[model samples]
Target: MTDHLPRIVVGYDGSASAGAALDWAAEWAELQADEPHEVRAVIVGTAMDPVLGGYRARNDDLLERWRSEAEQRLAGTDTAPGQARERVEVRHGPVVPELLRAAEQAAMLVVGSDGHGLATGTLTGSVSQHVARHAGCPVVVVRPRRSTVANRIVVGIDESPEAGRALRFACRRAQRTGESVIAVHGCFSVLAHVLTFDGAESELAARSLAAGERLVQEVCAARAPDFPDVEIEPEAIPVRPGQVLVDASRAASLVVVGSRGRDAFAELLLGSVSQHVLHHAHCPVAIVR
Candidate 1:
């Protein structure tokens, strides 16, 4: 039964942020105690020597050390009794590829961000960024938080399929954690600029707001039956989608967004709004594909 259940994989490297991610993942698994999941941690090692012209085998002592540390961390995480530290895998290869492979069939992949401020900013070449963009499953990039009192799951809502999936994911999480959901839709439309010359700016803005509200309502209504007990609050704000989500993240436990929005580039792996939120959101951000 455990093998058949979905896996929740955590990328651990013994950093503070990684330890936080492991704790978060373990607690998330505990939330699903009614239907247990397979929770595991992975540590990726290059173990390569350019001068040797071949991959060097990992020393047994070093492998055991990593495994031992990961297991200890998992055991120490706050989780329900009888929760086993199932697997602590140490794989050798490129970091991103190894982590992706470890979570190929996972329900969700949890990773840590450096929690850097605007001055330092999130690096484009970081492992979490690459994994969030390329992973087949939903990827959550967690940052160390000062508090978790804010229990709202803020999600960006739109008519796109990916956005709908993101909303569903957020609703499911809210259902499990007893958190509320905030469905936000930006009402800034390109047509507002053209209508300004004709003195129809106010009218356009009202229409845009109404349309945005309808979109959010319809989307939330569709999922209402599935999440009967989940609380959802819809908002149609006249602001940029990224900015709205970033502001909401300040008081949110988690901010969820689709990998690609309706107007995103077809060739891009990650959407601009998601990238912006991932870089700027105050809380953990989950990129659903």
Candidate 2:
């Protein structure tokens, strides 16, 4: 539901990642002692369609079972249980749409990575990605395989407002975990660059990419210079920003993305690609406004 403080909404479909997200969200929800927080466990149903391989998981009994399990999981892992304030929402609808809908009321959403999996294996699915693209708020894609505490915070920077927001948010998280922040700006050739590689345009593109990386580094250092206890390592990846961000997440605890607001972003704003990484990333993605 809506509140003055941010809430954590997680999409659950009996997947392990969802369970992990619930655990992580519960812990985070308790962090804001003064502010009210909520955690929702939503299950989205899919319509029968040939294109989607006609795969449909519709069982009221199963749904109830999952709900009980989620509650038990939350109860088990959540500390200071009696005093914490939050809600566990269980709704039925299209998974992605339901998540987006739940996101409408949440200041931030936390989801498990790879919600598509089996009894014991890596969960790699697209639900998180879908929500990241269309959610009304920032999304956090959690990696159940990793520890609840963050190892490192990774932010994709392009000197855009969204990216700046992501970096600042990431730094805050780093401060909480006493972890380092690796701000990465992925660079690569655009479609135009490929078309005009041999022309003068190629030179311009090279210069522009270089400048962008330098700017990302400069901004990261300026915005998050001294962590004292938490180390901040700003890095520049000379490849596609999304790819590099995804790669960075392989070893990171959290990945940050832009919320992709409707209004035009400022000079320091990040693009949709940052949003893209939120969905497909291997670790938790924190979207900053």
Name the candidate that leads on lDDT. Answer: 1
Residue 210 C-alpha lDDT in model 2: 75
Q: On residues 198-263, what C-alpha lDDT tens digit does candidate 1 reach at each position? A: 655578878888999999999998888899999998898978788899989999999999988887
Best-fitting candidate, scored by TM-score: 1
TM-score for each predicted model, relative to the true structure: 0.86, 0.73
Error of 2 at 136 (Å): 1.4
Q: Write the per-residue lDDT of candidate 2 for residues 110-134, one digit (tens) a residue.
A: 7777765222222245666666667
Task: Give candidate 1 regions above 4 Å deviation.
Answer: 50-65, 78-84, 115-125, 190-201, 266-271
Model 2 misplaced stretches (Cα beyond 4 Å): 1-5, 33-36, 44-58, 80-86, 116-124, 144-150, 189-210, 225-230, 259-272, 275-280
lDDT of 1: 0.79
TM-score of 2: 0.73
Least well predicted 10-residue stretch by lDDT in candidate 1: 116-125
